[model samples]
Target chain A: MEPFRRLAALACPLVEANIDTDQLIPARFMKESRASGYGRFLLHDLRFDAEGAPIAGFILNDPAAADARILVAGRNFGAGSSREAAVYALVDYGVRCVIAPSFGDIFASNAVNNGLLPAVLEEAAFEALTDWMGGAPAELVVDLEARRIAYGGRDAAFSIPDAWRAKLLNGWDDIALTRQHAAAIETFARERLRAFPWVAPRTDGPRGGAQPRSPDAGETRAGGASPQSSDL
Target chain B: MPATLFDKIWDAHEILRDEEGRSLLWIDRHFVHEGSFHAFDTLAERGLSVARPDLTFGIADHYVPTAGRPRIADPKIAGMVERLAGNAARHGVQLFGLDDPRQGIVHVVGPEQGLTLPGLVMVCGDSHTATHGAFGAVAFGIGASEVAHVLATQTLWQTKPKRMRLVVDGRLAAGVTAKDLALHWIAALGADAGRGYAIEYAGPAVEALSMEARLTLCNLSIEGGARCGMVAPDATTLAALRDRPMGPAGADFDAAAADWAALTTDPDAVFDREVTIDARRIAPTVTWGVSPEEALPIDARVPDPAALVSEEAARQMRGALDYMGLAPGQKLTDVAIDRVFIGSCTNARIEDLRAAAAVLKGRRSRVPGIVSPGSTLVKRQAEAEGLDAVFTEAGLEWRDSGCSMCVGMNGDRVPAGERCASTTNRNFRGRQGPGARTHLMSPAMVAAAAVAGRLTDLRDL
Candidate 1:
């Protein structure tokens, strides 16, 4: 992932609230390989008609938005589905940052992991940014170090979790970071296992453990009772 | 200070807190599906293996074929299932594969197999992982990157989300269900209302819900913008967890139940936010637009954008109405549907099947539809109860389990411009397929739609 410091790029506005991940890339196109690029599939349904022709009126279809790298979106952007492919679609399509009033819990974290910034501003600030966009492409500077978005000589403060900012700025591999606390994790795991044996994975073999296969679907178990059905 | 159930679980699992106050919390359970294959790639890129493969379980459902058994007709989809199996094999992670009797939607399979337990901190790559929180678990969704991080470290670095209490008290009317309550809450509160908070569903009506219904409630928490949704464990939770092939047994089970019983919010615990609803007020609600919040009661008419309070909201409503081909003041019950789907992580359990089946018992559906159970066990249970016959006799296809039309990834798609009455959680544009419109409702409501060939109120049926 590219380390994000500062990016001043052309921006487009998609100010529809609750723009879900299914609409971001659609479910059918998620199987494609990242090597081939997910850019073309980004907002595939929104950008095209049933016949696959690009909708002339769609903002992304405009020539000015052809090089857009930032999106000023509506509240609760990327609201449904935990598909990181949603973030991949944006980054692959050259969107480096998204300014919104709020974001889906998982989508925002996914953005940081993939070097895309999820800049959260107040609803008023987001509205101002979208108004400035005014159905036309504009240039906005997203400074990760400064935690601000600069547009038309006006700067708006944005917020992201401090940890996410750190991750994006350093382009750090989380696994590598966690490994540094290996000793502490080891101790914690041991204590948890000792205290809550039932909480541990139901396994019968060595370290990697055997598959925790259950009884056949036809077999009835004697120990547990199914919940007394209320109406089912 | 009084503690919330979330705080109790978070404190128990926190290994250490970083300078940012982000805790590296141990993950007791992690679920992966076909969408998680990307995470495996990340693990390979860094030359790391799953830190606790034993705790992680894989289910092949997202892209697995619903009609076919072991044979996935489409090569691309077949590869997805194959890759999942191969990944589970390589990691030594237990997989409820395409052929496994336990195979179903990941959320459904987790709770049924006793893998999802109270007080356990769980994570999955799919958003509906919150479904397990009905058992009092602190379960939430993760992205592929965090999925990979959990695989390699068995821990996640997360800043604690503020806690919120969503209380639903009073009596729920007949035909109203957990699905209705979920949608009703989302409609009452904007889609972004629960953002940055882990919401706990409380109050008497929530308590009265069956385990299955409770699962349905927590399942759609993400739609309301909650980080996760939970219900503190009670007798109902204990009964549900009783004996599972994977859960502890005998004395161990009793011990665990005691601990789970203790996992409740203190009476004086203060939430960062609280919203209470009169359960009696929620009717059989359904979505009228793309977003979950864009819904109204069955008796209501289509909303007029002209009457909306804000210009942006009005504009968005206009777009939704345009896409839906609905005119303002049009009766919601008068809307017609092309097909119906009664399945998804949201509403595909055995109880959900029974509810739909009860509505379809002797009546034939007016339109074509599919009735896919949540899991093979759920299917077997339905078959044993003769519910399969009810669905088939009612003109609905009694298909096998997998995500099916809810995601439209495995060839079960709603055609272009067709409107469907679906029990699936999402009603987002094209969620069922390209140009497909979906109406989110309960399984019983979906069955009602099937019989009426439109989005009819279950009460009307």
Candidate 2:
């Protein structure tokens, strides 16, 4: 994980929203391991034709956008079913950020968690940015720290809560976040379990059996229970 | 200090705060389906187990086939099923597995089983989890990681979202159902209109809707970019909640009703943003463009990029129109489709099936298509009432349950380059598959279009 402190303008003129997960990474691509180049399949259904041929009409087909790393989309970008492949696709296709008027809720979460900047801008600002990139290379500076997206020599500020932005910039998931509190959590569990033995698992040697286990062992076993539902 | 309905509910559910200051909101109910096995695996690897599995419930949906075999033969799918059972048993969570009469799509079973109670906060790893919000719950879909978090600790650390009240007044005209209203709202609100907000679909039109109709409204909340969409619970909601497996029993029912009555917003409350739509103005809308919000009435003409406000928009619109095989200025009804698919979380319930069957009873599909029920129960009930016969006789395949052709998760998919009139959400270019153009429509409208072999308006039929 690295601090996202820099701003670089990388723009693609294409504007499309409600881009589903399948289009981000088609179902056929999931057959491959996540360790493989799943990013290559990003926009598999959109960037290529049935025979894996490039569709000239597709926005990604334009020669100018060949190296573009940022995409500007219309309202409601990333709608439909929750498949994380869409983020993989965008990231794999060299897009690190997507600027749109709006994004699907699930899609936005996937983007943030996967370290993709899904910046929501005003409709007019989005349009203006894309319009500026119509002929020349579209440019936008995404400063994760400042929470601003500058385009066309003019910057538009947006806010993504500091915590969420930090998680994305650092590439840390929930597990990483939980690890940060592991020591404190462990102590809290040990203390709470000793005080509330009823909720803790019993470690008493099966009835009156001569089991060679310490009494505190059973106490700690039951005390190990975290304050969360285990599964379903 | 006027609190929006969303904040009121969010505040009520706050259990504690973590060191990072994120509010640990208590989750009243947790829903899961077959696709969430990965989350369970992640938990196992961490030497952790579900702490309060009793609140967790599992249903067999998503990957389950609608027909062919009662049990899946695919080793991976079978393994996933076994994992769900094993996980539920080990964690002490209740599961409604396949063959259980209560087994159905997660979204379908939630309401029918009375598990999605009003004022409760419901979370599922599935996007359509918003379907539970129809009961006036703070229902929303979470990610697999979040799902694991909830399973381990019946709570989620979340920043509270703002609220928006979409008041659709006036009565709906004939042929326009809740599906139509939702589609209209998504189109009018520009698909992402509800972003970062929880939307309460209120007003006379919402209250007048049946429980099933309300579910359809909330099911598409994710499609319109809202965290969740809900309607205030009323007598209709209470009546529907009755007789379900987990519904309130005996005197507990009366107590629950009193609490449910208070779930609604105050007479005068402020919203982060408000958008009003005239119910009467909406018709049996059909999407002609590539996005749900880009839809137009059947009578409306295909949009011309030149007429757009921005050059960027014009270019994108031009591409969408070209990809859709629709020319500018062409009537939406004039667009012919190669196939029709009417099944998905968006519109795959019993009522949706019945509505489509009613339109296709004496008719026949002009193209090859299938009418997949959302679940085994929906398929059984449809067959029990002869809805299957109507579909089969009309040249439409009456397949088994599961999300078929919606996202092409399974083998069922539309061929590339073929245009399809689908009742499922999203009309993004090639959303069905590569080269497969999709046009979103209501179930009845999809049936009408299937019979006509094109995008024909239900009004004309």
Candidate 3:
């Protein structure tokens, strides 16, 4: 993941509230691998019509806003669904920051971890910015180190969880950070098992779990111990 | 200080706490569906293996064909399901594949298989995992990055959400289902009202709800902007858990039930926030616009954007109306629909199926629809009770269990420009399909809409 410090780029406004993940990248587009890149699929349905022609009026489709990398949207932006690809689409499309009044809890987390800044402003402040900018193309400077955004001849502070800011500024991977507490986690697991063994999956209930395909089925392969069968 | 059920659960699961009040809580059960292969990709990228394979369960749902086995005609869709199997097999996680009789939506299969027990932290890759909170669990959804983190560490760092309890008094009026109750509250309070809070449904009305109905309520909590919502364990919860395959049995079950029953919120415990709702006032509600909060009673008309105060709000309302092809002052019942869908984590349990079946019995639908059960077990049981005949005779398709049409990723989708009366939770713009409008309601209400060929009131039917 990229370390986010500061980004100054053209900003586009998506004026609707509750812009959910489905609209970010439709579910159909999620069928392909992420390696294929999702920038083209970002808001595909909203930006295009059934005939696949670009809808001329959509903000993202506007030719002037084509190079925008900062998205300023309505309240509760990125709401609904825990699809991380929504963030991927934005990051892959060169979106460096999303300014909104609020965000879905899961989407906000996904954004931060993927190195996309989900900068939040008060509703009144967001409305003011939208009014000042309207649908016009403008460049906004986002300084993660300073926790401020600069545009329209003035700089304004934005708020993000301090821990998340720390993570992004330092580019700290969550798993690697959590590994420092490995001893505590293992200790808790042992103690928890001793105390509440019944909490585990007791597939031994009346119905009985008779799952097909054993976990150890790999041992039963015929001279296919490794991926070298053809070579042999 | 009196400890709430949430406090107890949090205290028990905390592996470590940081200075910012974020606790690294140990997750007990992790449910994954077809969408989660992305997490597997991340794990491989990081050269990490699943830390606790035994606690993780994989189920095929989002991309599985609803028509029947071997009906996944789209190779891309087939690859999603196949990759889930590949990941599960590679990681040694127990998978309920399509061939398994227990295969279903991850949220439904967890509780159906008794894997969703009280006093545990359950996490899933899909937003509807809150469905498991009905069993007194602290279940919530995570994104693929967090899913990968949890897969690698079996713990999550989260600031403990403030507890908010909605005390709903009075029993629901006849024909008012939990779906209606949830939609009513979400509309009364705006969509973002419950943000940063873990909601607990209390009071007599919540206590009187069936276990399945409680699951339905919690399933829709995310739609209301609450990540986790729960109802305390009672007789209904115990009865739901009894003799299930993934839960404790015999004397152990008895001991577990006693513990679960005692996991209620303490008397005199003050919640961080509290709301009082009169259940009697809730009507059979349906969304009129794209958001869940854009809902009203069945008899109400579409709201005019001109009446809205905020410019931003009015702009959104107008945009939603334009997308939905609805006009202000139009009667909801007069809004005709092209089809109906009756299956999702929100309302696809056995009880949900039975309620829709009761409404559709002998009454052929004027429009086409689909009725997929929550699980294959639910499908077989519904067939045994002749519910399949009810749906088929009414011209609705009888489908095998999966998250069909709800996510719109599979082949099953409401066509472009078509309107559908649905029983799913979220009604976001194009949730069912691009250019497709969705009006969400309860199963019975969906059935009535299918009968009337419009968004008609179930009571009138």
**Ranking of all candidate structures by their DockQ, best first:** 1, 3, 2
Against the native complex, each candidate's DockQ, computed on alpha carbons, is 0.39, 0.13, 0.29
Clashing pairs in 3: none
State the fnat of candidate 1 relative to the true structure. Answer: 0.54
- Cα displacement (Å) at residue A214, model 3: 36
Candidate 2, residues A89-184: lDDT per residue as tens digits?
Answer: 677677788878777778888777767888878777766677677744565789888788876578777656666787777767665555455455
Compose the digit string of candidate 1's lDDT tens values, residues A94-126: 999998998988899889899999999997887
Candidates arranged by lDDT, highest first: 1, 3, 2
- Which segments of model 2 are wrong by more than 4 Å? A1-3, A7-18, A53-75, A91-96, A99-101, A120-142, A148-158, A169-232, B17-21, B71-92
lDDT of 2 by residue, B264-293 (tens): 788778888888888999888888777777
Score chain A of each prediction against the true chain A by TM-score and list the results.
0.85, 0.72, 0.86
Q: What's the lDDT for residue B104 in model 2?
A: 63
User: Docking quality tier of candidate 3?
Assistant: acceptable
Q: Per-prediction TM-score, please?
A: 0.95, 0.84, 0.95
Q: Cα deviation in Å at residue A111, candidate 3?
A: 0.5
Residue B148 of model 3 has an lDDT of: 92
Better of 1 and 2 by TM-score: 1
What's the residue-level lDDT of B445 in candidate 1? 91
